[model samples]
Target: MKKGTRTSRLTVFVVTVVAIFAMIGIFAQDVAKNTTLGLDLQGGFEIVYQISPLQEGKDLPAMSAVAESVSKRINVLGVSEPQILIEGNDRIRVQLAGVKDQEEARRVISSTANLTFRDVNDNLLSDASIIKEGGASLGYENGAPVVSLKIADQAKFAEITQKVSEMGTGNNIMIVWLDYEDGDSYVKEAAVAQAGGEAKYISAAQVKSAISGDCVISGGFTESEARELAELINSGSLPVKMTEIYSNVVSADYGIGAFNKTATAGIVGVALVMVFMLVVYRFAGVIADVMLALYIFAVFAIYGGMGGVFTLPGIAALVLGVGMTVDANIITFERIKDELYAGRSVQNAVKEGQSTSFATIFDAQFTTLLAALIMYIFGTGAVKGFATMLMVTVFCTMVLNVYVSRFLVNQIVKSGALDNKKTWFGVKQSNIPDVAKRQEQFYFGPFKKVDFVGKAKYFITTSLIILAAAVVMICVNGFGGKGALNLGIDFSSGTKITVTSNETLNTNEVRSDFEALGYKPSRVQASGDKVVYVTLNQALEQDQLTSIKETLTAKYGIEPNDNVVTPVVGRELVKNAIALSLLAWVAMLIYITIRFKWDYAVSCIVALVHDVAIVLAIFAIFRMEINIELISVILAIIGYSINNSIVVFDRVRESVVESRKPKLTNADYKQIVNDSLDKTLVRSVFSSITTLLPIIALLLMGSGAIVTFNFAMFIGLIAGTFSSIFIAPQMWYTIRTHVKPKEKKKKKVKKEKLDELTIPGIND
Candidate 1:
């Protein structure tokens, strides 16, 4: 170690990190001023649109063309960041986050997308009647004028078609129509149609059939009927028929309750973690606790600086990460205890402890980093947000908890500030044999050196089978294309609403009655018996609103609070999410390759893919609906799996440096891996357990869509733990087996390369 240059290196590292913070802080402030606000914090308009299903025997492409057209139309409304998506087979949801005016949003969405009618000559014609009522002319139909109508149904079509057919020999049999007065049901009557016209106009029978799909027109219609017919012909049906299956408007009070509970949970978690670490390691633990506090500050700074949204899942990641913050300190402290037990002076023990723990810490952190990268790439929305926050926080945690904490403790010990060994966390000097100095070789009893090379074929075959099965299952389920995993309304099309009132009410009664009215209720779960979650199969249509209200009002004895937010999935959004996920993994793999050996990087990435496949497999097998929520858990798993691999590699690197065995085959070196796994097993399990707690809470107590996301993480964490310990170490051993031992003359040349493979003292 270059003693003189060490201080300069440390100074540079600190300065660089500080500079990053300063720049981020400046950008964060700018973002707060410029960035768009999400719908949650601000009151926004919730737009629910329906997807029109394909008519039987029709040549149309069903929902596809409608979806594309609706997206284009919505884009014209200038609703930036509006989520417009197709849901299931028949629905399109358009959610405009941060839209304040419900009426304004509705006006934009409720208008007919477009209605173009081609004449026999392929010429265009304009209708003045429908255009006056905010109706736009689509085109011409059958050598006549065709206009887009905003009428509720086809009555306008019938009147117009009848009048158009009765042009010349018009009789005085005037058909009276009505327009309802404000807040009144009765309509003021007026003549809309007259019976009798030339035979050139469409017949009654023909008009009826066409009006079934689009509105029809007839000759000799009065001003009112013609205008009404124009509106009907112009207004197009929704791509999918929908009902407000679920809506819950979070009242100010409920939001406050949720916020308080979440905040309390976070504060308690941090306090408990800090207290536990300080109590266990005494003086050294104090240093770790100080760093833990610093880590918290750094996490906030990074998130705020990055303009990272603090989503619920993101909160969970931070809480779990907090519990695991002291992991590096624990490893280091344990090493120091062992060194002190071996009759080393406090200063030397501190030095050795720091040196020994570096590799273990790096390995553990690196594995977590790998997982974070993978999740960030593959996940959408909140999942990516969580991954982004987790990766940044993990890096910050490592720096503070490992380096800063260690420095403070080590320097204090080295300065003779803590002269008495007994005072240093009550650590009394103890006599123990020095394993490093011993001439005798230590061995775990009865463990055979199994020849992995002999079993390579079987190993390869088994791995291929597992990998193949995963791919086959995904493909068969259409999980790879179309709709593999059940996508929630957020990613697909549907309406989700939550409503809460101070008065207690029957959630089921409200839900069932709504369902009975053809509201397409997907789920009705109660949060704390007072809050009811209602999910609809599709977005609610304007016509269904009155019926939905009547049903809820009848059942609950109260008008249902409709805080509706409809999110639609677009093809482009889906494509982007997939591309991002793939890109994340590719980018991470490239980074790993540059940092380590290409082989190691590839192995790590494959292991990541393996983890992701298993998670998706579980989802597909169980019919778990995919959504943005699941993305968060997947990201967390990536970090966990990679952390495990790094730990094993760290130990393997250490063994390469220290082992003097003449017959040190890859199998003989297996103990190094076992030792690393053994050392990490406790911390890994503990971290997983802590991480599971909030997810369990969320599963039992949180939102419906979020549960699936938590489950993904729950499954991923367990799988990641298993693969990291059992699979990753085995991979390293297998890879090393392929590296042939050099000839006696080439040994010197090989040593340098081997040294390159080994990161010295990293796994101390």
Candidate 2:
């Protein structure tokens, strides 16, 4: 290589790396700040409304209309990116992230907002029907805020005023009610309205003369109150009733604290991964680390640009993404090491390694990306956020981890920096074999000759024993006997509140407080020095919930994270999660079948199920709460875990094709499986470690719901690695060498018997 050419390539590599870092550094904060956060990450609330028909026997109200109503009402609250989604045929889920006033949001979203004009006797003269759609406006009346209305029917307003005026004395009063339900009268609600109870009636006046065309309702209201009244009126009334079937509210304090802690943990985890690469691969490791950084930034940038809701699970995904991202670089580096061990030149080895690793890396990443898309499509709330982050990570891995890392390393290889010392790629000088007499049976990896297939029986037995023990434990009060999986409010339909105080809290006191309000908690546990979690068996009504939250805040100096799930919503959530899990398995099975074969696909599915089952079993044994996030976590583990089996199977396929003979024996197939695993085992371990480092960080240092996410991820990673190594490939081997031959023998017997039947002389 010419000195000038090497200098140019090196310069290009440096500039590219610097530019990426510089750009990210300059704009990262702004993007992060501007990026939309989910209710779990930012302090806000999500409410799922179940709508019923306005009148009995009528068809259910249009979900779209209710969503529209919610959208208009929340829009008036000036909340950004309020997710108002119409779910199924009769539900609307409104997510208001970064919203401060939860009570107001709930009221506005569900209120009927029926404007009516009536007398003291409650005789309705006019209602919202006579008011123009956009007629309600906020204005000032004698320095007090008032709502002005443009009456569509002049004679109707004039008639109401004249009737009220002729009624005489204390009986001649006109009343304006926002939501006038039957049996509500001026006399009955007048004292309540004066004492500042519910703001059902906006304003009332004793009419001395008839007026028409335009009128103003003055209630000595503050500007905010007047503005809310105008917005409610202008948003138009919806006849349908919106019942809050589910809700998740996180206080701003908890959200911000979680964000900071999780982010710090992620940083520590990623830093550890980068350091691991640097120590293992040296200069090549540096390149991998650089690319990993770039991949991280690219994922965040894409997610932020796409207007994704960054959530607690999203943070966990990002951390796991770092670990997953490292696998891309690890594969190539290990492959390069293999080429070096085969006595290839530095440049040639770099080329061969990248070429060999690309297909495997692409296959692994594509499978994960496919699963994430399914997750995104099927998931809601935090799970959706996690899916988005995972997709971004896999996508960025495809680009940066594969292409960019390869390019950067190629730049170094082409620059001739490591030309004289090929060991810089991590292979030892004495390890490179002589090319002139290369052994035909040479195993090309760093793993020892362990005879993985020879121990298949032991591995399978161990797996069965552990699984059986888990089942037995569950039947004996682990999960199946006592309470299965410790299902969170998301599945059980109740209220779970996490109250953070300025000082230490007594669990007994927390229980007493709830008991004081007539809500006996199912459980009260202290989560931290200043935080206590209270679980109620019943989901509270909206008003009752507001009162409880207000009381808690007043006493604790923090608004608790309140989660409420109704039976209807909980059932639906559980149903959807199960269906999505099955769908993911089916999709993965079909995909693997197309990519590999039926045996490998089936084995992969078995491994996936095993990984999921292990996580559930462990969580059940430990009595950890399983929330909605588990759905995404399990899917992510399956999607990511199968890549291990896929990688090994990919190697196995190559070995099978290369070792094909006229008559191959079972021992030959066994040797093939063993040899393939040996070749890929080193990479598998490295990949898993690199991926798990971040999750371990999250598990140890993270806070709130994220710890649960990371804990599950951490266990899933181990189970996935174990299954890929022990169970999946062994199952495939058996199906191939044992099962297929029996079917062949059976077919042969049937064919011979048919031949004997067809030729009667042969049978005699």
Instruction: Compute the lDDT of residue 328 as modeled in candidate 1.
Output: 74
Local accuracy by lDDT, each model: 0.54, 0.81
Among these predictions, the greatest lDDT belongs to: 2
Model 1 CA deviation exceeding 4 Å by range: 1-101, 105-254, 305-308, 334-338, 341-343, 356-380, 417-487, 499-508, 522-528, 541-581, 593-599, 606-610, 613-625, 661-663, 686-705, 737-764
Give the lDDT of residue 348 in candidate 2: 79
Q: What does candidate 1's lDDT look like per residue over 1-764, in tens digits?
A: 34445555556545645664575566655544543333332334344344333344444346676666555545544566665555555555555554434444454354442333212221222232332344433434565554333444446544554553453333212221111112321111111113332332221222222232343333445444354344433344333333433232322334445544555656665666666656666887677666666666677666766656554566667766764566677767766765555445566778887898887677667656765776665554455667777787778868877877776675556555453453375344334333345422222212234433344457556546665775666677684554555666655656555645456757767576666776657766665656676667566654465466556555545444343335434343466556655665676577666555555566677677778877877776666666556556555666566765655455555555556554567666566666555545554564555455555555554543245666787677776666665566666666666764331221222231111111237622
- The most accurate candidate by TM-score is 2
Worst 10-residue lDDT window for candidate 1 reads 184-193
The TM-score that candidate 1 achieves is: 0.58
lDDT of 1: 0.54
lDDT (Cα, 0-100) at 379 in candidate 1: 51
